[model samples]
Target chain A: MRNLLKILYTYHFLLMFIALEVISIIMLVQNNRYHSASYAVKAKAVSGSIYSTVSDFKEYLSLKEANKALAHENAILRNYLKSNYGTFDTTKISVNDSIYKQHYRFQDAKVVNNTVNKQYNYITLNKGTKHGIKPDMAVIGPQGIVGLINGVSENFSNVLPLLNVDFRVSARLKKNNYLGSVTWEGKDFEYCTLKDIPQHVQVNKGDTVITTGYTGSFPEGIMIGTVSSSKLKDGNFLSIEVKISTVFKTLSYVSVIEDLTKEEVTKLKTETEK
Target chain B: MIGEYIKIALRFFFLVVLQLLVLNNVQWSGYLNPYLYVLFILLLPFETPNWLLIILSFLLGFTIDSFSNTWGMHSAACVLTGFIRPYFLKIISPRDGYDSATRPIIRDFGLEWVIKYSLILIFIHHFALFYIEVFKFSLFFHTFLRVVLSTLFTFTLVIISHFIIYKR
Candidate 1:
């Protein structure tokens, strides 16, 4: 026992080093796999407030650009208004519309923090649980899909952006309805790779890709990006490169999508799997 | 002694703020992430106890991790850096050995010694950091490129900061 105590005293520095590293690694694994809501919640409140204050100053610098993007979106929305189009058939036909209920609700939020360079990137928004934002909700920019909420605090939330390596979403080609999965290769911010599309399916440059709604986080038909190129891989699957539509660097504002039927869909899915 | 401690504490605060507010936001390119916060660990007094060094390094890394949402990558790397730092210092000591009361700074040691010291430590820190971040061996060459590029970027910043801070 005396010899053992002597040995520990001599190697105490190394033991302390190992202990600290082990703790850090444990935190890393927990943060990555389970998203460690308890720890992140407190950290988010402190960091989120700092980022929001800094972003408030930055918001003014990008006001001109934000105004232009908002104006363009407003014009597009105006074109869809019922007053702009006339009905060719005036006959009143009452269809069974009660079956169609709202499946998604949107809340506008300002991006207080965003990073695209890292292998695993995250975005922070000004709105959080206080504003009804929750984990697993989808976030979309003016042009296309952004990401999904992974962590939330009282007045802030973190988004696992599509640029991250772990982010994968079900998407389909708009031209032929062929399904594939979109994943970032950690190479470029403006592009992601689409895999699992069979080689037999026709693909071409500039073909549009949209969400398939299979994940239930995002609704159907939201734009992801257009195919920049496609190649045959291993004689079975076509590895296609897609140029993402949303400009992540200049992202200022976004909409958080709350899928109202998510609980019902998830419950049904679990039952089916079981 | 108290004054020296106060200075170290101030440097810790300054470096953290600079890292989170300025360096973290600097989008030079996807590959050039210069982590200037490690400078805090690099510039510590040689007389600092080993256990205190490791704990301070962990705290510095954990603070950065909390703000950046990187969790534990930085803390792990910083602890390793701190663990190996004394050995590295011993290896690179001058023919006569280090002065008793001198801190590791550009003013105390010449530019060449400081560069040689920081370059090796920074490379190791970036190497450990990027690999822990990717956490895979498949993209070996890709992560290697990032490590090299980031080390060079960080080295240049450290040298520039030395001149900026120590200029009389």
Candidate 2:
């Protein structure tokens, strides 16, 4: 025992170093796998709120450019509303059911930490608990749906940005409504992969992709990317290549979609699992 | 001595603040971010023990991680640098060794050795940082390119800052 103690003390630093590194690796894997599963709704809201504030602070310097972006988005949203729901009474908000149908509200955030070059890209935000932001809220930008909120603190939050290898967004063809998983390849900032797409779907370069509305985090029709290239995988699946339109290295603003019906949906999911 | 202590402490806080607040946001390329803050770790008193140095590195990295929203990139790099520092010092020891050396000034070791020592550790630290950050070895070519580019940038920054401040 004395000999063992002597050896341990002699290499105590190495042992501690190894132990901490192992713990760090474990934490990294666990955080990646179970961020949403473990923390779920409440934690994400806090993170979303943090990023929102951070983005606001960062955008203060680029107010003119941001105003232009806001103006452009406003014009697009107005045109969309005019074409889709012209003269409809939006104030006649339905109590229970319509909330689920449009269960989300969008708020803007900025990238405090963004890395397109990494296998796992994370973005930190400056908004937090005071902002009413929560976990599992879908984050979006002018180009398309960004990613999900992951970590949160009292004053800040981290996003598992779409550029991460671990991210697999459920995307579909805007032209024909075919669905697949859109993932990153960790090489470039502007590109991603659309896998599990069945062959014979008539895919081509420049075909638009959008979200499938299956995850209530985002409403249907949020733009994902355009199919920049594609190849046949085996005989049935299409290995479609997508180029995301969001400019992340210079990304300044994002909107966090607050899901109103998240609790009920989560409760239903838990009950079904049980 | 008291004044010197005050100076180091203030510089430490300032460098950390600059690292988290300003340098963290500067995305020069997909592969590069400048870190002049590790100069602090590199410039610490030569006789500080292994455990304390490692712990300090861990703290510095952890604080940076908190600000930048990472798990352990900087912390891991800093600890790695601390661990290897003693061996590097031993290899580069002068005729008289560490006792007579009062500072890590360039004049003491000449510009070439100083630059070489700093670059070696900086390369190890930053390479480990980016490699672990990308988290897999699959994109070997791409990651290697980034490591080289970022190391050059960081080394330039370190050398420039030291020349200006320490005046050796």
Q: For residues A147-176, write the lDDT of model 1, one tens digit per residue.
A: 989889889998988988888899999989
User: Which regions in candidate 2 have their CA more than 4 angstroms from the true location?
Assistant: A1-5, A32-57, A81-103, A108-117, A124-131, A152-157, A233-236, A260-274, B1-4
lDDT of 2 at B116: 87
Candidate 2, A113-230: lDDT as tens digits: 5666556667766655567667667888887878887666666566777888777778889888888888888878888888988887898889999988776487789888888988
Clashes of 2: 16
All-Cα superposition RMSD per candidate:
1.9, 4.5
lDDT of 1 at A68: 99
Off by over 4 Å in 1: A34-38, A88-93, A96-100, A267-274
**Steric overlap count per candidate:** 0, 16
TM, chain A, every candidate: 0.92, 0.76
Q: How big is the positional error of residue A129 in model 2, measured in Å on the Cα after superposition?
A: 4.9
